[model samples]
Target: MLDLPPDLPRLRTLRTWHEQCLREIDRAIAAAEEQARAEQQAQERRAAATPPPWMVGLQDITGTPEELHQGGCTMWAHRRRKTVTRDQARELLAAGIRACEFCKPDAELGFL
Candidate 1:
């Protein structure tokens, strides 16, 4: 609750006050939007700066590693994937797990 001044009895004065309030509200909205944009940009930067996992192990229905893919590979549509470390990826590739043709993790890890 705000204590409005009783002296603003004139229609012109009230209209002026209303315009000022609208301007203030617009300024506040603009400031909030700017802050939101800044925050979203910061979030995007953080996501971009964060590196993807080095490798991803594509698993079969049995939950066994079936293929190796580079971290950024999107060719495989199956959701049965697990993040793998460099060494793990190498071991899997060396164990004869087929590397994804789209994102050759084996070649990336010198397993080609």
Candidate 2:
């Protein structure tokens, strides 16, 4: 067991010091949390500013022509993909880029 100091002044001083340390620690944690929140908001804004294109075409490993798909197609989960504009998608389709069987980009583009 720890022995308590008989002098009240010393005990009061120690309590005050402990409280101040705790307050400082709390302030530091709050500042770190605020910084994290600001960073996440900035990232969200950047993502919103440059939204993904409406259409995308998955390319082969060699970056050669491959299947065309919509932006949210499931086939692209494991495939390499690149975003393309609507006109570019049409051109790629014309260039024999096969439409994704799942998303059916051809029907969405009124090509079907």
User: Distance from true position, residue 21, model 1, in Å?
Assistant: 7.4
Q: Which stretches of candidate 2 lie over 4 Å from their true place?
A: 1-51, 54-61
List, residue by residue over 39-97, the lDDT tens digit for candidate 2.
Answer: 99999998886635445544565786588877776677676777788898888888778
Q: Write the per-residue lDDT of candidate 1 for residues 11-91, one digit (tens) a residue.
A: 668779899999999999999999999999999999986645554555665788777777677765456777788888888
Residue 104, candidate 1: how far off, in angstroms? 0.9
Q: How close is every model to the real structure, measured as TM-score?
A: 0.58, 0.54
Q: How much does each candidate deviate from the true structure in C-alpha RMSD?
A: 6.3, 7.5
Would you list the clashing residue pairs of candidate 2? none
Q: Which candidate is the best by lDDT?
A: 2
- Stretches off by above 4 angstroms in model 1 are 1-26, 41-51
TM-score of 1: 0.58
